[model samples]
Target: MKPLLFMILLILFLPWTLRAGDATLVSGTVKSITGHPFPKADVHICDSEDGRPDVSAQVDGKGNFTISTAFRGRAYIVITAPHHRPVGHAIFLYGQPTLAVDAVLETYLSGTHVDSIQIIGDFNRFEFDNGILMTPDQNGLYSASIPSPKKRTRYQIVIYESKGAGPRSDEVRSINGIQYDELEYDSAGDYRSVINTTAPTTTVSFDVSKLPIAQGTGYLKLMDARERDLVATMMSIEKTIYNFQNAFIAAGTGYEEHAKLHDSLNTLLDADVEAYAKQTDDFQRELMTLRMLSYVELSGSLDQQQVGKAIGFATSIPPSSIAWSAYPTALGTLLKASGGNADTRAYLERVATQNMAVDVRPAALYFLVGHAADHHDTLRQVTFFRQLVENHPYNHFTTSARLSYVPRTEIVVGKSLPAFTFPDFEQPKQSITGSSLKGKFVLIDLWATWCGPCVEERDSLLKLYRQFEGPQFQIVSISLDSDPQAVRNFRKNGPEMPWQHVHLPGVWKSPPAELFEVATLPKIIVVNPEGKIIGVTNGLKGAGVDRIVARAMGQ
Candidate 1:
């Protein structure tokens, strides 16, 4: 009986023991683009690049390194080296004891005089000094091995020399075959290198030229070659018109040039859309018409007659058609284009009451609420929000609608200013806090490096500061930039703003911004000598700012 009981216990606990001790072994070799073995490369193995690594290793003379960790499933492998572009890859390590990843490092520098190189990105928060440095070899190539970033992560590289650091470089892909656009460090810049570690959705890439004709044509097996040819020709014309419109907008072409291009494109698009609308009763006709109308609306060059025609065309589409899903968006555009007239408002109200498709109703309600809020119709806004919540309780828009009802604290006269502390951009040790500015009237300028209007407002602010130059008045400018280096570089090269500048690197979500409830750029908040909030406005020049300051100074 004792032997049988022991056997049963071993059988029950054996599975648990195996699971508790499940360790994965990951090993890899590093190589240069020329197939030479890469040595002394820093290797990091982590669940994500943004997060701390579970294990770190350096490649040996033979360009090989290994790490053993309890982490299972998917893993990221990030490698870095001097003079070589940093690259990363994602791999799965489940149901196996070991996984191997061999990767190539690309050379980023072509000329000499570069003493060192480092990478700065979301992984390092874009700090100039706080980055992973690469090790150089006799061949002038650098290498390092570090854990990889999580799947779908983005990052940028920064090259440094004896004078100072160069601007951040573009993101490098793992394959090294194709080149992506350079990463932008500006506030509104949308360039970042992405690491995709999953299987692609489609085996073949979509062809842009064929996209217009192929979309809805998949179901028309009975159509003749002649009919299909006509559809293809119309699609080709639509594509040409769209391409010209996009080019003109991107180039910032003059109004005269723009108007000429717009007329030519609009004529072609209108003719094609009218011909197709008469021929087809299918969803394709509705989709094509909506696309043409959206282009005109986005161009911002539409006349009154054009706007009226787009509205009528949008309303003609049936609610049950798949193409009807985009009608709400088109309607919203027309409503805005018509300058929110009575007719447009009535049409929007009618659409809001109709039993529209699930995918389109939330957008229609959101536009209605926005229009009401823009006009300061608080009651109408609240009613729409309530209707949206009651009708679509589980929709994604419901949460946003509920949050909209939460009243934000407005920074105005007679309220104690919110307290905050931030590192001075020039001197990190000496902090600029709310408590430090007690005896002086402070004009707190919250700005970002990427905001054009914010930079433009600096000159006026400087003039104001010089006008009231004394011990009692001070201007403290706080920068909400993500990278400290970007702020530093801008100060070195950009226009001079002579004032007490503090660098708080969180962009829009920085601590001071959160404390002051700043939602727009060039936000100026004036605090009195006793730390009482006196006034708040989007611009510093106009809107009774001078009056508020003069009163505070007892002028």
Candidate 2:
């Protein structure tokens, strides 16, 4: 009986002992490129999601620190120091009792005067003000440590100067030694930088100088070659189509020439798709697919037979192909060009019902639902949105469909302008309110400095402003920049619109934007003398702006 009791007790305690031993001790040393230790550098061990530090410690004057935690899965270590770029690394703690990491810090030198630096990222929801400050050393290097309660793989370091130094500017720079998407911009117009701590390190390096190309022409040369090749092929097709169209117009016939040109283009597109399908790289295949779709759109109108052929071509690509996402847009364009025939509808229905990839099915369904919405078929729109939400409850499309059901504050024509108060970009203390612009025909331009389209539209906006620069008309240019300095920079260096500019630093989530449901930028809302919204459009192309201003001024 004594032996049996002992055996049971041992079994019960063994599991507890094993669990207790799973706790990990993570230690690291941070040094600068100059071989100097980062004294009192901020070291954070964070949870993978929330970015809250679980265990934190400071590097001593010798640049050494240690943290012990019960975390048994993946986590992140973030190191920040003054004058040095913030460093983050993803680490896994399973099957290890202790782990040591040695990091070499790089300095932040963007040829700008920076009074302070802080680290911010997705782990903390990218809140600019909720940044972790770094302490600067005598040598101009800074360091700090915080306990990381979550794990994250990406972050950005913001360098800020003093507030009164010509608009309180801040510069966000990418972390070195990491590859990130060049086109990933946040709502605030800040570029996103990614760090892959999960990937294995490779030490292979190659010299590009040995290649038969000029120093700066490596990527440019490749881009030029691609552009030339595409343009040559497109021009050849364009010449044939041009001649065919001219002949058809002159003779009031020649359908055979049109058919031949269409067939030839289709054949070329098919061959390109087949070649792209053979590529091992998914991104390359997707690029080729996009090129082919562009070719189709530019070729000409598609008849019933050609529409069927295009749909067949799209469906021929396997659901597993990465190029599948491109098909929805291609199919939607073809359907629109084909005037939405029953055959096209059936093809879309087949895609939606098929056992396709998770992404493909919802995309097909979304196109159909979007088509219904475009036609103002409210009943069909609601029904399809409901179906999407019910069938794919966890899909991203379902979330969008759910939001579509929510009642939004309509800023439509004949409605009163939503009341808002924002500070002037040049003078933050002075407020600009909706009531102040009463009795004036206001062109309320909601825009951001970093938006390329918005910047391009500046020329058109200035032309309108100059055309109607009187007491009856005013251009209230509202900037959606998070950093006030960005607006100031644009005002000083970019186009001088000479209009009443307002700056409210919330970007897309600003009060005015949220109230008006301003999802896309360069949104222009024209208000009459009665302070009622008269015209709202996402674009201000051609003489449309002049006509709107003229109508508003009662010209």
Candidate 3:
């Protein structure tokens, strides 16, 4: 839907105010995974039919709540408890004066299913090998007694499962799973045990009957048929994806498995979301679009195929103004850094070059530029970088970075290095001006004591300086550490970096940092003897640094 139309429909969903006496009252008990009362849960009575104003209430410490809505008994309810997964979506309570809803939510560990349950947590220093296997009693019920830890412990349930010639998952549980859309919508907090429990705390039980989605009983009954079926499909998707991940992790490699799971997740975006979009008004679609941005990011490490699918999915979203504002920046990062395939590159090129997709163009322009840089396709890198700068001169993505702060064209090979200067770290009298380093190939090393990569590269940089520092070659290491003392301390305690040193010490805000537009480190800028730009790189280190500097020096 067009954003304008979406906004227009929102007016229809606005609530019609009524007196407090005529309000619909919703009362509920918030139950933890253990079937005990949970305090401080939030219940929201929403106009599910339309996106009207929601009446919300926070449960008291006793885990009971009563909330009144202006709507006359037609509403949808959502429940959230602190540090716990939320329950209720498509749980529309219609034409009821006063209603009672007892909600049951599970810990993060509850999602992982297994034939046998064992707990691994901070109590065991998160050691999977020494996990405490729960004892099964009857009807698939399991129980485990843990010696209470001094502080709250986070954990996950694992079972004995194995795949040959892979990490011994049975011996030490795997921390991998498929992230279904439902869980993505619901906040996934760290699985934490009850805080500061005293002695006589009852054994935490996993009664299969009481479990919500696990047993397909508790909360499913509350959801109407349509919602129940939708959720069931979502759950099934999660299980299939979960099994795929387990197999992938256990066997340690499964390209096809990864691709299939990736496609299944995307189906949630396409089939499920599209079907729902048709059912709801444009206002809800707008909200869904916003959520779609958040939803796309739910997965952990992506395979190349997965990355391609992700790009395709995000690119397909219609560019609404509000959605585009922050989306492009993230989208740009994704484009520039990840995915390698014909579809990925093809989609990116279209987005970048297509003037109509202004919001998306910034990112599409970004992907190919970085792809060129990664393969050392210097010509394409320069071409794409120039396009990125020219096409996005008045870029919209920078207006608010969800509220970040993009690209180096000025310092690319064949361009003249912009004039800049910085004061010496040890001596205020001495300055390392761009003009002073003339008639020599200069390596402007933008680094910091705090940057791990920068610190790690000190030895290699020192070697580079020693090998090439001559009348025709000079190396200037600029320190962007916030404090000059950190550099001094690092120099004193760590590897000897005996090159020409200049401290441009406001970090990124430092004068030379602005001149270079250095966003990441360790940044290496190589310039030839005549002072025209030689090359620029973000993480060109180890053997690559020597090669980069040597090529610039014509040796």
Best by TM-score: 2
How high is the CA lDDT of each candidate model?
0.54, 0.55, 0.53
TM-score for each prediction?
Answer: 0.40, 0.45, 0.35
Mind giving the per-residue lDDT tens digits that candidate 1 earns over 342-390? 7667666666565234434555676677678768899988888877777
Q: How well is each residue in 1-555 modelled by candidate 3, as lDDT tens digits?
A: 112322233322223111233444667677776555653466765442244325667788777789865443113466765434455543322234665667776642343344566765556765556878879886677777666554432444554433345334223322212211111111121223343455532255555444233222224134234334333433443354345434333332334654565565565556535554474554334334433333344333334453444455455544432233223434544444344556556656665544243445555555566567677788876777677565555442222111112335576788888887667776878887888888888888888865545654666777777887668877788888777876777666566667788886577778877787676678888888788887787756668888888877677
Please give, for residues 496-540, the per-residue lDDT of candidate 2 as tens digits: 668888776577677767766665567788998788999876544
What TM-score number comes out for model 3? 0.35
* Predictions: Cα RMSD each: 18.6, 17.9, 17.7
Candidate closest to the true structure, highest lDDT? 2
After superposition, candidate 2 runs with Cα above 4 Å error: 1-286, 291-320, 324-371, 392-407, 450-452, 538-550
Question: Which structure is stronger by lDDT: 1 or 3?
Answer: 1
What is the TM-score of candidate 1? 0.40
Better of 1 and 2 by TM-score: 2
Least accurate 10 contiguous residues by lDDT in model 1: 211-220
